[model samples]
Target: MEEMSTILSDLDEIKSALKKSVTKSDLTDIVKSIVKEMLEENKKEMETRVKEIEDVYMRKCGDLQDKIDGLGLEMESLRELNAKKDTAIRNLNATLDDAMRIANEARSRSNYNEQYSRKNNIKIFGLKESNGENVSSEVCKMLKSPAKVELKEEEILAAHRLPSKFTNAPRPVILKVKNTDIKSRVMKQRAQVKSAGIRISHDVTLLNTRLVQRLSNHENVSQVWYYNGSVFAKLVDSDARIKFDITDDVDLKIRKKLRHPST
Candidate 1:
């Protein structure tokens, strides 16, 4: 009975030690469960923060794209406006060119009419003028003596002394003949009359007069004269005669002639 009691006491001691170990293992499992729950909660919070940041970034990108699209539209509108302005400028230039052409045509026609009206007139220079003298009788006497041409009083349609720029010099005379044929005959004897210190020329337009003077002053030209209301130029060392009108480009024509004499 004593031995049996001692064995039972030993078994009781082993039971107490096993119970202590079970209690410690249960505490370790509880700690591990708590740590896992904490980690899950933290992970959820971080994911939420990341999602919010992504939403904000997407909104900013959309706004920037909208602004870029708006700028593109504005730039396209500006390009169209510029194109329209350029077209309008071209149209205005064309209209201005047409107006200038019409103006030039009208001016040319008016000049032609003015030149045609003075066709049958002649001017006499270096003729003596007296205040009360019969101008027609004096003209007849002068033409008969120096020019060797007889003219009836009726052949001269009109005669008058032009205003003199020099007070002491003789005034020039402008005369209208009955016909162009009679005027031609009188012109034929102008060289003979010029030998007696007289000068005769056609009453040409002012533009033609300037052209004649310009041609006379040119080094390339030998003589400039008028015949049948047209101005002509004789080139130096050339028999080629150039007939010029008021509308001609005289300098360009002369240059062309000098470069290509055959033309």
Candidate 2:
């Protein structure tokens, strides 16, 4: 390292000394010492600027810390609110489940006699078919309740049984579904519409899609759908009995048609 005062002294002395047979080595040393001093001065100025920047950053850090603390407080508040809401929802769910169980029991009891009557008279028989083949209701019943049953289109016709095809009419399938996706959507829509105080008719394929979508928006809705322009949906079990004109309230537009009678 070049000594600061020595470099200054060398520069002062070199002018007068250079004219008096100064050695080449002495002039080289003086020039190198002056260059080192200039570099050191530049380094000091950079250090002063760095310190100023550090001070400004330290001030900014205080503001950042305040923002972080505020955000933490807001997060805590939201957590507390969420906890309360969860508790309230749990209580409501429990109450709703109890009510639905009672309603299901009542409905089951009302249908008991009809089911009992059918069970008592259900006959299993075996005989030859009209085309001179061995076929019977008992055989058909056995065929219907086959182990590892995979129903095919032909068997339904040969056995004189109704096909399990979904239709908008008063079909046996009750709910018309083409795939699992549609089934899931329907189940969800059913729960939603029922929760909104809508009565489920015998057939659901007569509902309107837009009305069902509106019911799906409710938190309590479990399913919703519209088939042939009628409204049908299911509600969360807990809220099913809560009466409301859901179809009318949701602004569903439906036109009733005259029933046709034919032989």
Candidate 3:
């Protein structure tokens, strides 16, 4: 009877344990909890990966921005240097212009001085050279034969034939008259002497020759000639003398109406 009672008590305890331990609702709840834990772990892992990506991209973006800033600084430096170079080039150009202006002024003064030195000289061609001949006597005799040169031999300061390397071309005679009146007289009789093939001209500078030729091409310039190594111009109907200056471009039309009575 005692053994039967003990066995019956253990069976009852076993039944109670089974009834409390394994309900279907509790089983479902446990599975749900396990799944929720796994999902939370997966979400944490994904967030870590996302943070890593963000960090990598942020570093790259920072590098790119730094490069852009460095390039901006370099560009600014280059612009400043280019501006300085432009200023330097402009200064050099201005200095060169000043140098050229100074050079031109010096050349003009030199040419003017040369022209001034030869003011009292005259050149005559077609007079043949003779050995040991008195040039003044020859000139006076030649002047009297066809047309009288109003100047006396005593009034001649000096007369000589120009030295030449070429023999075929006749050497011209250069004469310096003593008095201004005699020199004027000789020059005024140039037309009379020219009829006999005598060429009388002022000992003009090379510049004057070119200048006279340039002015003679103009329609308003009737007579273009040199006197006293300087170039002179005459209007078509006027006798007023115009000094042809190469430095200043004076229009001939303005001087055309300025007619001085014939001297």
lDDT of 2 by residue, 101-197 (tens): 7776665454443333322121112221244433334333332343222323333223231233534322121222234343343333433344443
**CA lDDT, every prediction?**
0.85, 0.46, 0.79
Off by over 4 Å in 3: 1-75, 163-166, 217-223, 227-243, 248-263
lDDT of 1 at 1: 94
Q: Specify the poorest-scoring 10-residue window by lDDT in model 1.
A: 103-112
Full ranking by TM-score: 1, 3, 2
Query: Lowest-scoring 10 consecutive residues by lDDT in candidate 3?
Result: 254-263
Question: Which candidate do you rate higher for lDDT, 1 or 3?
Answer: 1
lDDT at position 176, candidate 1: 84
| Rank ordering of all candidates by lDDT, starting from the highest | 1, 3, 2
- How far is 177's C-alpha from truth in model 3 (Å)? 2.6
User: Once model 1 is optimally superposed onto the true structure by TM-score, how far is the C-alpha of residue 143 displaced, in angstroms?
Assistant: 0.8
| lDDT, candidate 3, 1-263, per-residue tens | 89999999999999999998989999899999999999999999999999999999999999999999999999999999999999999999999999877876776677788777666677889876678888888888878877776568878888998887778877889988875577677788888889888888877767667777778887777888765646778777776777766554646433444542432
Give candidate 1 regions above 4 Å deviation. Answer: 1-93
Q: 1-263, model 1: which lDDT tens digit per residue?
A: 99999999988999988887778679889988899899899999999999999999989999999999999999999999999999999999898988877776776667667767766678999888777988788888888999889977799999889887888878988888888888888889999889989898888877777888888888899988887767899889988999877666778888899888998
Q: Pick the candidate with the highest TM-score.
A: 1
